[model samples]
Target: MAEITDTALQGTSKSPNTITLQEFNNRIKRLLADPSVMNCWVVAETTDVRINQHCYLQLLEKNPKTGATVAKIKAIIWGNQFRFLNARFKQVTGRDIGNDMKIMVCLSVNYSPQYGLTVVINDINPEFTLGDMERQRQEILNRLTQEGIIGQNKTVPVPPVLQRIAIVSAAGAAGYGDFMKQLTDNKYGVCFYPCLFQATMQGVKTVPTVLAALDKVEQNQHLFDCVVIIRGGGGTEELNSFDNYDLARRVATFPLPVIVGIGHERDITVLDYVAGIRVKTPTAAAEHIILQAANALAHIGDLSNQVVSIARDYIARAKEQLSYYAGNLPIMAQRIIDTNTLRLQNFIQNIPLHVQRRIEGENAQLARQKDAIKNAVAQVKMKETMRLEALGDKIELLSPRKVMARGYTLTTCEGKIMTDAAQLEAGKLVTIHFRDGKVVAGTQSVIKDK
Candidate 1:
């Protein structure tokens, strides 16, 4: 440590005094080392919290209304103290010191020539943060109630069979894996189509990423029957984001029913209140869906059995009807045959007498027709004989022998008979014939009549 002088503390601009960096820091250290102000409790919001072997962070005291920082200080916790304080805080509040956390911490002011001013945190009042968180949560609940949206999702009906699911979760989280495993390996062999919309489930990004995931699910709402927000296997610090007003409101009014299972039994968030269905763990959410599907399947099986029973009953009735008809068929057929046989016997007895009467009448009618035919044939023969005799007389009057006998002579030239002078030539042979004689002579010159 360097020496401090009175001149360094009181100096004019004309003769300015200088002090070594270590000397200046040593003076500040002495002032802060007072017993009254050395170790005390301060309430502030945590910021830039980094935890490892030791914890390093900033404490911020802000104006309540404006939310502008009024005081800021560098703070840290040594490895051993941080372990004890964090363990105790987690046990009490279900959370460790995290960014934006309101805390009342017991700290001692420290200054070093090399390290400047910083507060060393020794213990924390977990109840203070816990109370503040509860107050904020209540305020959110009141706002949601006033808006009348806190029970909106609860009003949506979960489908009897939850086949398609829109899941908002960290893709690789142990909770998501456990949920999928339980659904896949259920004893009832139920199937689920769980499409994951990945989001950060913890830390500063939790609220926005989850809200974005819900928006995506909304855009494709037709693909899912319900929404499942599952963040299994995370500490209570991670659960704080689920209490956010914006995230809770979004879940409460989402179009599809939302199921929240964040894997915490001791701590419940505002989300649990707003969600349609809330369960302790991802496995429980899976089991709920499986049970619904199993019930629906059982219902379907029962309906199928009922249909089979009805069909069997119908078939049994049809068989009885057929059997009744078969038993009466032979008697009905025999009665019809006996009636027809009696009618045939009566018709056969009248057949011979009817034929005999018909034959006698036909024979008398034939005798009458024979006499009429004989008269017609005799009249026709007499008419034809008179016509033939008149023809013979005409033929006798025109005969050549008859003409010659009546003094009409016939002349012939060689074998042809000549009736004209043009048929005769000088010195041609001629023949003249009378009734019973013929003369042959040499012809003289024939003359034409003038």
Candidate 2:
């Protein structure tokens, strides 16, 4: 692609004011070397950026809609200044000064007979690059958000117990070691099975290698509870790979929950926002898993304690209830028996007095009839007294109170009457109801007659 420069002196050769092309280019270069044009700002979009001995940049202005170049210029950044300038550019914008970068470069217009015309770029304003980066990042993030990809991986729930973990990182990285130590050998003595799917943690191969590792984990997804990505041991000087749009899309829409620990203390990568969970360092991510195991143990311990305590409390309450029944049962039964006995005794004493009064009244009536028939009256009075005495004895013999008083007793157990001798067995408790009182007794032994 040819550079856009001043046209050659075609008809100016006839004019003496313009000399040969070589002399004319040299004179024009000398004139443009003023204080203002020697080192001034130029805004253009970079096209071809090649780096061998020196950095070569092809700057161009393109039609916004048509994508056709409207203007083009050649630019160069010396190798001597590339180191500090590239570092500063990446630090401020979180990306390298690469092709298609909209930049503001400080350059000097140079015209040479051999090299034609070019711009010698010496300095750049990183602020422009930063603004452009922000704009691009915002656009990508917004598109992802609108497409509803941001929460796709977030919807996958992390398993309650973290045992199998598929890790993507450099195999011998310090970050990986720290994560393993924190997880497998935690203070709680929890064991974790960490499988390493090694990948390049940084540089050009970072995104592709990590994505490949993720794909492998996905293939064996059933074997793992979750996926963890850990990268530490270096600064975020080349962390733009983490913010790659393609990689971010894959991570944000993963089938399983993704845990990222990229070890960046400065700006968060787009991966961090799209991941199911993000931690500052690999060890911190490990701690989060260990905490889950610890909490599970704690929850189980609490439930066990609750069950044992409840059982003990139930047994104690049952014992108290049994003791209450045992202590009050006999006393209540005895009180009822005593009241019935006292009423029966009063009725028996009144019966004898009433019989004596009835016999005296019969004797008085016979005496009044003695004046008419004295001999028959004496015989009749004796027969009547004898009959009354026999009736009183029969009544006394038939009474339940009298029957019990004659060496007979009714036995009951727990308030139920016992009718058979079989009911009187060893270890069986019974109450004996006598004529005057009752006795509660537990059977120590049973005796049977042949």
Candidate 3:
């Protein structure tokens, strides 16, 4: 050892050791803070991510071939940058990057011996994130299908009429407003009792926040008839949150019917597939409800009209029957009267004819007997003429008509003949019967034997 100078004592340093590890790190930090050596470059794949409460993110990248982490660094996104990054990422990927997603980042390299790490993030490439989103969507879809929960939500019964609805959406979102207005202004007078289960509609925390809202609705199943998940218009990337398999499973197994109104006609999510009903927009969902209500009302109206018509027909038939009976009543009564009058006339005519015939026959028989008696009396008078000459003379004396013929007129009162002088009275009107005629006479005198 030659007598080394004080400089040689530090192993013959070519330059003086003027900087410490802390000093070098501070200098490098200052240089990186400048907008020159710290440039931006896009890299693939995100790894080893940490989030701080200050809204700064620390991330790293690794090499897939070697299974080794070559790019180990500490990258920071400030609170403001973090917000922008989160929003942009969600806009591009429809999801926020945490530990789960892979992202393409624009970053700067930083090297320092004391800090012993490098930083490499400044921005993100949206196109690359979108591509990643498609792959993730397919993966989740496959998982749900394999897990047999793809058709789970479809099994829940949708109410025949969608009256009470539970909505999970960002409050004040244009989508929510549209849905409410459409339902309220429906022409069918459809009523909706909307119970809002508010949640984040987009971002890294969107899935969990939405799931929590769904959980509340599920726990209180009686409060709602159906669950509706709706969102405002957005890019395809922003819709990726709905493709999650876990969220799909939850929706599939929900007790009540689920409806999704998430995107336009071109966009279809896993949630849409799992939901019992999927509509292109929130307004369309409202229209579906109105249509169901209209159909029900129309059916009821038809039934009511049918019932009324049937009642009217029955009344008309009854009136016709009553009129028929009333019209026939007079004719039936007249027929009865005519029949009874004909029978009484026939009976009276027959009775009179029969009585007249019977009286005429009896009179004829009496006449014949009288004639025979008269003939017998004449023969007897001829045979006894000689012997009865004296009797004949006596009979002639007793005969009143013979006495009247002999100029002795017979006087009778009330059909009795007056044959004695005692029957005469003074001032009495009497009938005198001769053999040929009767005379009215007044008695002049009367005498009575003592």
Which numbered prediction scores highest in lDDT against the true structure? 1
TM-score of each: 0.63, 0.59, 0.52
- Stretches > 4 Å off in candidate 1: 1-30, 111-116, 306-450
The model with the greatest TM-score is 1
- Output the worst ten-in-a-row residue range by lDDT, candidate 1: 7-16
Which scores better on lDDT, 2 or 3? 2
Q: What is candidate 1's lDDT per residue for 254-356, written digit by digit as tens?
A: 9999999986676588999999999988889998899889999999999999999999999999999989889988997898899999999988998998899
What tens-digit string does per-residue lDDT give for candidate 2 at 1-450?
A: 866555654424564564687888777778876788788888889978999878997999889999999999878888979877988987887667787679999988777768777789989999987776677777778888999898788889888887899999998889899998888778888888889999998888999999999999999999999899988845443666787888889999888789999865665778888999888889888998899899999998999999999999999999999899899989978988999899999989899898999999999988877766977888899999999999999998898788897889988987788887776779988899998999989899877676
Regarding lDDT, does 1 or 3 come out ahead? 1
- Supply the global lDDT for candidate 3: 0.78
Report the error of model 2 at residue 28, Å. 5.4
Model 3 misplacement above 4 A = 1-43, 46-131, 328-450
lDDT of 2: 0.85
> Which structure is stronger by lDDT: 1 or 2?
1
